[model samples]
Target: MVSRILVPAARTAAAARSGLTMRSIVRGFQTSNVVRQEAATVVAPVKKPVGAFRGGLFGFLLGATASGAGMYYYVIDEYRVSNELLTEDIYALQTAVQRIEGYVRTLEEKVHSKKK
Candidate 1:
């Protein structure tokens, strides 16, 4: 019976020494002089959003520049492909015309030989 009583008493003494008692916990939450003074005389600044393009000045210019560059690149690439196709077509037409001319010359020579 004495050992059981001493065990709990020892635990309570150890808790008090380690500052785990109820009185210490209550004192920790009590306001001090510095905290009270700072709270009484504090002012917070009002935050505002930065309005660099809320008036639509810089945003409009940037968008226009990007659009113009995209259009220029697209036109240049389109014309490059079109020029290549046109060159190939012209070469084919020239070869066909030369073959037709040769056939006409052969027919003319045959007619002269027959007349002779």
Candidate 2:
């Protein structure tokens, strides 16, 4: 009850001492447009970034080069691994065929010897 009144009164006194009351704030806002207009007449508009297009192009080229190199490395590595596996498979198949040929020749020699 009394506290509410005292609080408002204290705030008003403080605002008066600080020169920051609502009316003064509103008056400042009313005067601000004139300052803004004067500043607008004195200052230049901001310019666009001169290097923006060049920077973007350089970034795109760098990304493309990196992606191309990565793809080339991946393909070369895959091919090397695939070729190694194929060579191993071919070597195993050749060894198996040689063993089968040896057995067939041995059986043929036995049959020929039995004929005599």
Candidate 3:
């Protein structure tokens, strides 16, 4: 009779310990799952269409400004080249006028000498 009672008490103690261990394991898993869910919620950012639109607009404006700057540089370069050409032409005309005046003076002197 004493053996029967001791065996039942021992089995009950072992079963209770196993149940407690299983409960602890289940609780740990639940806690870990909750922590993971919370971390995911905190780390993930929400996307908005307006933010995307703004970024595209900013990029387009930057491209437009760059193109405008390039056009301005091209126009300025053309103007500089034209001005240089005009200055060279003016200098050539002045040189021709001086040569013509010298030739006229020489012709007039020769004609007077022949007449005298």
Model 1 over residues 1-116: C-alpha lDDT tens digits?
A: 44435456666677688878644333234788999999988878878875877748778888999999999999999999999999999999999999999999999999999999
The worst-scoring run of ten residues by lDDT in candidate 1 lies at 21-30
Number of backbone-clashing residue pairs for each candidate, in the order shown? 0, 0, 0
* Candidate 1 accuracy as TM-score: 0.56
What lDDT, from 0 to 1, does candidate 2 have? 0.83
**Clashing residue pairs found in predicted model 2:** none
lDDT, candidate 1, equals: 0.81
The stretch of ten residues in a row with the least summed lDDT in candidate 2 is 21-30
Best by TM-score: 1
Q: With candidate 2 superimposed using the best TM-score fit, by how many Å does residue 19's alpha carbon deviate from the native?
A: 14
Better of 2 and 3 by lDDT: 2
Q: Which of the two candidates, 1 or 2, achieves a greater TM-score against the reference? A: 1
Across 1-116, the per-residue lDDT of candidate 3 in tens digits comes to 44445445566577677774333332232457888898778865667557778989999999999999999999999999999999999999999999999999999999989999
In the range 1-116, model 2's lDDT, one tens digit per residue, is 44445456667678778988545433222457888899778867798775988999999999999999999999999999999999999999999999999999999999999999
